[model samples]
Target: MKILFHVLVSSILLVSCGSSKQLNENKNSLTKEINKIYQENVFNGFAVSIVDEKGTLYQQGYGFADISTKKEYTNNTIQNIASVSKTLVGVALQKAQELGKINLDDPIEKYLDFNVSNPNFPNEKITIRQLSNHTSSIVDNEFYLSKNYYLKSNQDLTNVKLNFDEEQVFNPSDMKISLQKFLKNTLEKNGKWNKDSFSKNAPGTIYEYSNIGTTLAAYIVEKATGETFQNFTKKNILQPLKMDQSGWTFQDVDFSKFSKLYESPTTLLPFYEMVTYPDGGFITSVNDLSKFLSELIKGYNGNGKILSKESYKEYFHPQLSATNFIERNTQNPYNESYNVGNFIGYGYTGFIGHTGGDPGVLSMMFFDPKTNIGRIMILNTNFSNKKGNDAFYGIWNILEKYQDKLIK
Candidate 1:
């Protein structure tokens, strides 16, 4: 009996040790794959996080915060997330509902002091829901895409520089209009695009991705809460997440810890600012963003620390798809795979997130509700480098291709 007992215990110990060894091996493999990507020198810097319902499973920052300074980028290095900033605004809008600030079904013009209506469909009002879903019929015109507007922005105060070639481009000090003023010109009846910006279709009739729609969400937050979008998001979201290093404007980030936007492994790009800060203006770290991503993943499974169950549903439920009520489904002039969801876009079947890009920056963040898995990838490089990974655009394109096998 004593001999048998010893053998049983030894066998159990061996099995336990073997299991641990295999788990470590798997984790090491994933890390090695990520390291391989980092060593490729595709972009100057990147901060990534992979998570599930429980919490962050992996996170690392590669390269330098500023190559000139030789400062290393860590899991905590904060940088602009581009349009991925919209997801943060999505959750904030849900919180606004919890705070009894506004309803999703409310007409957006009800919150804005200015009138924003589709000139072609003047009788049909654009609701907060339509804006969140990218079905508001608003379009981006020359002004939204013009460099001259940004040249005149407050961002010009700092002799901003940009690199796009192993490339670079400097920020121009040239705009006379504030964000609100620009919105007035584009959204109000007398505004330049009031007639042109509105698509031929009626409001909420189709999915026309708009930066204007996302920024309006932040504006509504301000209009309803009577606080600027930055302050309100800080007090309610950043503070609670203990993301002290995150903020909207340049003044909010600690330059010592901030990563320079880059086009190549060595090139740096000057920053751009927008009065429409809510759309894609946030600067955040992997650690801080992971905290928020976990909350979102948790919400995907039903409840989250920040958003309640009903609010979560309202924020994530898919609103339009080819099989659904969309009148017209164009090839998404930018990226056809891009689809619309409630206040955000669907990355995949179970994903509700957003993508972002600028002259030299590209980013993606999305969470799968069914698997409770989430991934975030940001490259100081834009979509121009579309050669490898079988014509994939950036780091995100490759990461997403191997998301499951590489992340787990």
Candidate 2:
């Protein structure tokens, strides 16, 4: 009897060891496959993280964080994670709602102190839900604001040669001011924009994917909390997640550690200031972001240290279907669906997050609630045209290859 029991115990131990070996082998293969894609794609700076149900299985950084300086990419190097910042803001709004500080259905006029000039929209009530879903009829006139501000500031430079069409200008500062003014104006006008000027779809009817909507949401968070948006996010989101490396502003960040923002093809541009930090203007590293995703996957409930599970669910719920046009234009083709604050996946893996891109940055973060698995990929480079598109595709392909394992 004793001999038989020993044999059985040995057999069980052997099987367990074999399974562990297989897990490690699979993880190594995933790392190799991702590295191959990084090598082939010529991505200037990139970081990828894959965490399973147990814990982080693989996290790696490849290529240079700064091409000119040849600085190696590290887990701590911060990259601007454009639209991914929205997920954080969404959580903040939900928290405020739960605290009885605001209501999702509250009108913008209730919280904001500005006046809108457009006369199309009816009913002075633009609800918080509408802003969160991008169903608010806010016209994003960043280009117009940029042009007007530039021409007004550079009146004497009219004779100076121009790169884009004289009519096409990109003014970062003016874009921010325009959004703030528009939000303030919308409140003052009692939510009266051109009827047709707003989307025909009823509020929260369909997703239009407007950065303006997100900015309004941020403004609401600030007004309700009586705190600056940046401070609110840091206190409510980043600090709780222990995401020490993330920040909405670039003021005190150590440039030596921060990944240098690159402007594609070889030129490097300093990070452009974004007025709409709520939409797409936060910076973080893969290591810190992995921690954030872990909390999200665990459905943190803002209890002791994390966001409320209820708020997390509300953010990931498919409030409305994102417009096809917006989906097609997204940085990740795999991100074909949209939720309230996130993008839903085709499978039953729950919600997959969105990606963000700008002149010198591209970022993606996705988490599966059911499986408690998540992945994040961030690259620094403003690939001029198709190059950026191709690089993003390469990253998506890498993520897709491991989707089953990552989402499991």
Candidate 3:
């Protein structure tokens, strides 16, 4: 019996050693392939993370976070994630519901002082659920793009080259407006910025992607919980997940670690903030976001920490049917608009997560339910042509090809 026990122990040790060796080999190969793509890419800086339900499997950052200063972009480098921030809104909404502060079905008017009636459908009462699913009939008008962005206060813009699209204008810092005022002006029936702000479809009938609509949902969470949306999320989600490096605004994070966003490989953009920040404007590092993604995967599997299982169910539930969309994106597997959960997103291929794009930023985060493995990629430079697009997806595909090999 003693001889048999010794043999079994030796066998187990050998197997463990073999597994570790194989994992290291896979990691080396993945790094090599991803580095190859980065060498030929046009973007200034970017980061990628591969995660499972438990934690990060592999993560790395490449290129220059600040090209002028030669600061390398690392896993700890932080930047705004654009619309991926909506996923946090989704999580915050569920947490609010779990605390009994609000109900998903309640009319938004119950919490808001301003009247936000869609003139096209005046009698319809838009519920929180409708706003969460992008079917609230609210539309992002011209003002959303032209008037919402402001240069960060005290920035020296004298030498900064402000290259942007026509709709992407940067207002002076003094021109900034509060989140409530911005939403009221855009969504209220009789406000200065209201112009074609509501679609012809009634609430809960058509799917229209609205940044302003998302910010409204977050604002509702604030009114219901009697707390600011930023503070509410910090206490609940960020704290619980130990995402100490992430926040909704510059005030919440270390500004020194923030990356300088690029218009092109050679052109840099002036730092700016959005008035409708809840829709997009989550600033975090890839390392911190990996923790959040892991939590989401755990939540999907009925083991989340921040929100109850019941709340997670509603948060991930597909709220839109085929009738909700006039045309669906059947091509891109990373496209989040294929369908939507509370504020979460479903791809055409059944992956669940969100994608976000803003001036000088592009980010994708998604996980497969069957495999429970996820991939995230965040770029500081904007991609406009086919070459940049191909290179971006090329790095993503490399991650997908090797993610399972890292699993043990």
Best by lDDT: 3
Candidate 3 has a TM-score of: 0.98
Per-residue accuracy of model 1 over 339-369 as CA lDDT, tens digit each? 6545566643445566787655677777766
What TM-score do all the candidates reach, one by one?
A: 0.83, 0.78, 0.98
What TM-score does prediction 2 earn? 0.78
lDDT by residue (1-408, candidate 2, tens digit) is 999999999999999888888777776777787677667645787888876435565688888986766898988898678777777777788778878889888777788766432244465457787777666766565332232222213122322322233443445443445446645443344433323235555554555667767777888888898988888878878887778878876663554577765655365554455555577877788888887777666663233235566766676666654352344334433362434443223222344667777656788777665555677888876565675567667665676577565332
Residue 167 alpha-carbon offset, candidate 1, angstroms: 17
* Segments of candidate 3 deviating more than 4 angstroms: none
Q: Is candidate 2 or candidate 3 better by lDDT?
A: 3
**What is the Å distance of residue 236 in model 1 from its true position?**
2.3
Cα lDDT, all candidates = 0.70, 0.64, 0.92
Q: Once model 1 is optimally superposed onto the true structure by TM-score, how far is the C-alpha of residue 311 displaced, in angstroms?
A: 0.5
lDDT of 1: 0.70
Residue 34 in model 1: lDDT: 69
